[model samples]
Target: MRHIVIRNLGPLAEADVFLNKINIIVGPQSAGKSCLLKTACFCNWVEKRIQLSQDTDAFKENGVFENKFLEFHKLYGYVKEDSYIEYENDSMKFSYSWKTKVFDFSWKEEGRWNYVCPKISYIPAERNIVAAIPNWFEVSMKNDNIRNFMKDWQEARSVMTEDMPILNLGVSYRYDKSNNMDKVTVGDGVVLDFTNTSSGLQSLIPLLVHLEFLYTKRFNTEQSKNILRIEEEGTLISIIWNYAKNKSHGEFNIEKVYSNFTEMKRTEVFLEEPEQNLFPPTQGVLAYRLMDWARGEKGGFLFVATHSPYMVTSFLEKDNENDISLFFNKESKDGRYVVSTATEKEVQELYDYSIDLFHNLESLG
Candidate 1:
């Protein structure tokens, strides 16, 4: 994605913003990083679910989805006692005004109307996926395409264990509301119960399941052409069975699917200070593993907001030449917060600083 300029945005008089495939925002506390993220989420939410008549008190009071134009004017320390907020996007030169509590919001371009917004999926820093899994699963299963996909998934699972012992794969809820119930396995067998696992593990199950479904769909279409050219007839079931056997060696850890979620399979992850809770190294490792899984699948993007230098250095040591961006804010002569990206040389300096701090702490012990 490209940098989107935000003029007179929250705490930012003006900024020429650009988004990287892997964008990282590094700045001191309260320097608008989180604000930028919130704004992006708000814009995305509005674009995906626009209904003028719906109640919007939550957004207005919580500051979760403020009118963009009004937000800009407020950020710039400007206000009109009677005139309603009015703002325009120069790129599209779009304009809109909301005066009465109830009003329709619309966007226009070149005297022609277009989609006012776009869809976006936001995974906040709080990482609250477990609470939303039920709804997510319901929506996925409700779609005909997704329902058929799950049926194929059941078929593949059955064929893969034709003679081998079942791993029990933990307890999972059936999508069908009529069949909505927990599945369990007794004795020495794997159980897919999210409740019994760590939060990190539970957080990744839906993403992994979705990816598995998508991969199966893509593979079927891709393999058909090759099979036709070779004058071979093979069903998706056989293809999946062989693929699973070769990939898992007949002993798959279903938990690993969530544990290794990355954007792309092999890209580097830049984490901001991840040791906030004084969490054990194991939890930290699991978090990194999940991030790596997402990276691997989606191609790695590095832009992490962190406070833990240990996490930062740990990743750096793993890949010496890996890109590391650091942010520290200082008041400019005019008394405004100025943001800057850490260069390679600057990162090296921070690395040295971190090492000294680490050794100093060790010496104290």
Candidate 2:
């Protein structure tokens, strides 16, 4: 995303962010970092899902286009007057026109990114809740961000059958073993279910599993390779929950046969607060892990929202050297949240001296 405009959405009176490949959003509480990230993600979803191929009739009819556009805004139940999100680049311009109460999508037929619509996933700060459960139904939340994150969490957790890498927690841990299920090796001879592991591991594992599964989907694997495929529901969540509930595991597969996706050309990941359950040193590791994996997988884009200095400073390290764009959200003098952009050099110098940072969005209320 290159250009972002938010009008009268919550604390964001009006703001703009010019994004880069590996974009980082840093902010104090209620600064609307997640708001911006989610808005961008939502617009991207529309750009991908509502392709021009099937929209000739829909576009011509005003009501038809408006109705079709409303389906994607289920997360935002109602839009107050003069509130909108606009994201654009050279090829296309996408905006939610509050006055019209519909999306204004303008695109060129030959835009390259349009063909290979990217996959967007969120790793929320509440991710530990996802890994804590062996199985769960589709959870609903009033907050669209958490709700969408849960949906992705469900899909990502579905395919784990093979024993994962053990999380060394100094002492062995165990849960009620059922059906000789998957386990993580923590010690020399100790094995335990993933849910019974430490909080840090729990939070990290689902994201790792989901991204790895997606990477495989784009590169290698199919329905025949899946450990369990539920053609009835057929969703990755359906199959994954079944495995979690019934104690069965095999290689998991998320095939195009089940989803609308053919294959991933690029991935767009939004990670919120990766430093939550991690130690100071581990924050850097997790940051690099996220950046390295996404870049290595298919030269994808990454958007991270963080409150940790370690997380911010990781990009300044020698290994990552200027491969990031930092968006800092702070309250303007008039007490409205406004976002500011910093190049790599600015971020490194500012963070290196002033390690004191503010709290995250969640902690504000």
Top-TM-score structure, candidate number: 2
Model 2 clash tally? 3
Candidate 1 structure quality by residue, lDDT tens digits, 305-360: 54455555554444433433344333445544444445566556556787464333
Please give the lDDT score for candidate 2: 0.61
Over the stretch 261-298, how does candidate 2's per-residue lDDT look in tens digits?
33446678887787877788878777777777766746
For candidate 2, the per-residue lDDT at 79 reads 41
Superposed Cα deviation of residue 122, candidate 2 (Å) = 2.3
* lDDT leader: 2
lDDT computed for candidate 1: 0.36
What lDDT does the true structure give each of the candidates? 0.36, 0.61
lDDT of 1 at 316: 47
